[model samples]
Target: MFMTLTADSGADRAETWVERRRPALHPRRSWASPEPFVRRPTEHNSGEDVLGAMPWTRSASGYQRITVAIDVVVALAVVVAAAALGGAGWLTAGLLGLLATGTHVSFVAALRGYERHNLGDGPAEFQVVLRSAVVVAAVLMAVAFLTPVQVPREAVLVGLPALVTLACAGRYVHRRVLHASRARGQAMMRTIVVGSTVSVRDLVRDLGTAPHHGYLVIGTCLADVVDDEAAQVPLPTLGALSDIPQVVHDHAVQVVVVAGDALGGPALRRLSWALRRAGAELVVAPGLVEVAQERVTVHPTAGLSLLRLEIEPPRRRLMAKAVLDRVLGLVALVLLSPVIAAGALAVRLTSPGPAFYTQTRVGVDGREFRIWKLRSMYVDADRRRAELLDRSDRDGLMFKMAADPRITPVGRVLRRLSFDELPQFWNVVRGDMSLVGPRPPLREEVSAYHDAVHQRLNVKPGITGLWQVSGRSDLPWDESIRLDLRYVDNWSVTMDLMILWKTFRAVVGGAGAY
Candidate 1:
């Protein structure tokens, strides 16, 4: 006969059943118990999960709060230092403090939003800094022009930009350092995943690939089964679902990722509640794959956790793009006019083509725009492209030839120094491109792109971008695409400036250039 063991106090009280089962079974007894075993019923409802009963651990939350507080304090200190160096009076110092505070608040808000809504994949450090800098710059400019404070116009113009730049650069360095520390196994959260073997294994694999998330999954709890096959799960199976509380207590788990579908409603509820009572943060990993966090929302309906996934609309920041491109582009063109003239003269004397080479390239949407570049190849370079196809050295939708014979003698020198790209400043001025964005693909290259690759066209192409300064032509096709997608997902003004700065160094170093 089969025996059905029922816990009366609800599933959460089921752990006591383990103790109860031990007593009823005599030592060396092999026969099954004929009578059904039932425990005394309690007030715990079926809807209550382990997460609900468990309180989030104070350690992780406390550290995050402390880190944020320190960031704010350091930012304020930097502002005070700036004021001291600038020799500003009380009003000026006050204004600088206000700007610094606003920047810190905005950055913290963006980071929190990214963590809560972005599903760990959001804008890069450069983009966040860019947005904050833009806001700070606008506020300082307004105060300089409108306020009666005796702040020097030059000081306002110079000091504000410098502070904004420094703040962003410093933040980027901090994030990089933090990530490096995490990679070295410092400042990490110990986590345990509770679910089926398959789902938990996959989640562990994904997490292992991204150490920057700072979650170290040290153990897995098999909630449903307890067979040898279940032991095949990648992580060490601490115990069954009933053993979660004990395992959590023993391992000092900071976070619990409960895969709900694998555990069933009742078991999951108990596990969640147990985790909460044990002071561990519960992170539910819904089976949704490849969905951006920005597209998901948590709506609590009655008592059930409702997850609503919304598709993001295509970006509609055209006015911002136009204003940024034209303003920065005009300034760049004016500043680099002498260099452009010299490049043009070199091209004219060295090659049988105009100083500037304008070609129709794919742009935002499916539109085509005439992109300008200083002549970096022979006049008949296009005619020679077909012959060089067999020598294509790169991958993906694009084609690259490492040693194309069509390049003019002087063109190689210009390309090395990125001098041939000087004329593209006019493209920026014409609003066909930005100072920073994805490199525009040739029309033929766009035609070869897969469906997902089309997302790169969501924003205007740039003169200098992640690809240019990162490794230029040296990066593999996959890496190039990854960097491009990263840029598109997290576009910001700060990133543009950072890329521009890097581009200058890259050009001077002549690394990874043709």
Candidate 2:
């Protein structure tokens, strides 16, 4: 008979799993029983049968290989182009090209660019690629200056930038493809979450919202005392902390996430050893929510590794960001004037309303500002809002409807293509908003905000933010709030640029615009 493990004690509460192949010779043992419950060799318990239960997803190593190949190809292409432009001989160009490619790839590998864990996730991968390029360029310059070997100026001036740019573009395209596959549930790692029921439940919910991250939680292991919250979790309780290895083996789990104080240092170390033998990855949740990797630094002291999280970004960086926002905002407004004018004219001609719509939105520090947008709704849209409030497709203070009746025919196209938001560049230029920041909220939404939600007001609101590129109106209220808070706490210039780049793709795709 198969054994069913439970947190409760006593033989009477013990349960058996699967079919009863033979008679029970004695009462089943509890989880605390000293005698180990060993399973007999049966057709059902074979290694092949267990492994076949959940086959591994497309290996991350495969993508890593593809990334390496792309980088090498891009580096070589850049070298060839630079050599051709510089009129270098074949012998010298071929030698220098091979050397440049080797140096670039070597530096990237040294910086953990090809690490399976970092590939296709977060901004770390792109950061690593850029760092490698900078390092390679510096090294080439140093070698040329310090030694007799002459380095081509074009290689340093042209090749480095092109290589980094092309490499980053290639990696970004690959990441999009990976995300697309993951969205379809095609590429995902089978995972088991271990923690208290509450933590496990929260983790599962959060991970479920971002499936592109590629973790598929198949089951959970309750490490703390079983409580009422256990029933609320959707994943099956595979076993306790002690039975983690068995659960992993049975389910073919590729990743194990340990949340909360589920395991002590020694226990966690042992668990790591067990995972090593089992060929699985162990991830420990630091319990820091919405913290960016940049602000965190690991310090080893007194034989203990402590994570130091910076409270705020430096004032210098904040000043720089403000300048960047204003400059970019002004440039955007200047460059996109024709498009904005065309959109506004369309709105005015197609609907019986003003070309531009302005509304009061809460900005940094509870300040109110008039935000601009090309009119994307009928003249009486605001008046009709109350009647259609009950038909809202979204929950929370913010209101949205996939099939909103208030929008004009031309308005739908404008909203879908994000032409309606172009006029917000003026708000950015006016210093009332940011080029990239938290989502701008209406007065009604701001009034209903709780203490935690109010953290979003610490920075200026934006036309496109983490919320927009993430899912826009499709995102749930809590998820949107979490993203906004994350951005406010962990704001950086690099992060702003990344979000700005993603905004174009999000707007073009228009997946969640409505």
Candidate 3:
């Protein structure tokens, strides 16, 4: 049977005996004995464990509270502003303020629910707008019925849309600023690894590549069975598994990740108990390299954690893609009809080919589709592609030339402003593409892709996506694939709207267009 140490008076003696029996259990070269420290009884004795088990971190909880507070404040401010615009009356304003606050709280709750379900991040812009509009509409109808405020229904309608737009826009801006700040090393979580040196080293190396994830590896603890010299990972070897409780306390670690296949059931249970007492989250990294998060699930049975890994299918339903394409494409074509005509005329007058170009690109499940675009290159551009292959300016599976000779003067302006993509909005409406999705590949490009690369075809191709907004033609192929896969694993309507909004700004600025 395994020995257990309770968190009472006996802890100090037990810890001292363990330390004497195994000096190597303590951190490397630390002469101080582990006997001086005493483990505190858990707060669970006071019935606080229920609240403590809430999944959110302290920082995340604070953010949620601040967000709620801000929404309430904004709702109150809006009520005052509306009243000042001639909708004044204390009773009316108070009612409106209550309604607005209730709406804000409801939307915030919806957003939180979405996040909790891992459906995506935050509520979609359209959903929020729709909800806000319903509330405003009801308020206006009530006011119209209740009092002779002399407010124009049309004016209220127009002003309400703008207000909703501003609120959503402000949220988008705030989130972006927060994400940028976090990316640049603010508000990061301090993490420590508990495992064999090799596993910890590899995990650290993988996480180091994505600074946006906001993980800071402070140190690593080698398993008790492993020797001290095996700490080949770049992080300092803080101690062994037995010393985890002390290391966590000393470093104030927010997350303790156990890596490797070396940990047995008893050690894992002990580490989990220690982590619980220390008020730190415990994450275990199953040694599956390069497997996406969506593919892994944990099942606990009889005190043993069983990980289930399954391969995801590649084909998404064509019907949904088709419907999205047709509806959005038709709407886009209508809205941009004048620009499309002007662009077509410009291309026709300057270039010898048709104003619109068609190319057979690889579509879902290795099928082919004729993609539409405003012609941005000369008729013989394909013939010229080979001559410029050796002078390729971009790297990865795709080819990009910064200053291709095949682009006509009119094409250059269109490409720079992303006017060439206007026609693809029609494709989006036509069921041929999505407004935001994986970038469709050419037949030749698909032919060269390895098995893993085929995962890109899991979703319908999009006119603009992470690749388009990030750096467009400037990004390398491997990084593009990574972003594409990330989107596939975590696609959300909020993400799609965010990408579309960023695409507009990117196109206007003409950054990385070539």
Question: In order, what lDDT does every prediction score?
Answer: 0.66, 0.80, 0.67
Candidate 2 root-mean-square deviation in Å: 7.2
| TM value for model 2 | 0.82
2 against 3, candidate with superior TM-score: 2
Clashing residue pairs in candidate 3 are 322-431, 325-428, 325-429, 325-430, 326-429, 326-430, 326-431, 329-429
TM-score of each: 0.66, 0.82, 0.73
Candidate 2: pairs in clash: none
Give the per-residue lDDT of model 2 (tens digit) for 403-462. 998999999999989999999999999999999988788898888999999999999998
Residue-wise C-alpha lDDT for candidate 1, range 1-514, written one tens digit per residue: 0112233345534543432232111121111223221222223222223333322223334444544554466555555556656677766776676666666567656656233222222345435545655665566567767986544444445554665566555555655665776788765667888776778878888888788777888888764555574667767776655556555655666787876465444444444556555556667777876565555677766555567765443345546657778987898789989989998898898778688898999877767899888888988989888977878887765667778788888888888788888788888887788788888889888988888788889888888888878889888988888788877775555456668878888988998888
Candidate 3, residue 435: Cα displacement in angstroms equals 2.0
lDDT of 3 by residue, 206-275 (tens): 8777655556787887765455455467777777766776676666667888887645444454556666
Q: Which scores higher on lDDT, 1 or 3? A: 3
Model 2 steric clash total: 0
Candidate 2 stretches greater than 4 Å from native: 1-58, 147-150, 181-187, 224-232, 249-252, 348-354, 378-391, 401-409
- What is model 3's C-alpha RMSD? 7.8
Q: Which ten residues in a row have the lowest lDDT in candidate 1?
A: 23-32
- Show where candidate 3 strays beyond 4 Å: 1-65, 79-88, 99-103, 106-168, 224-232, 260-269, 286-323, 489-492
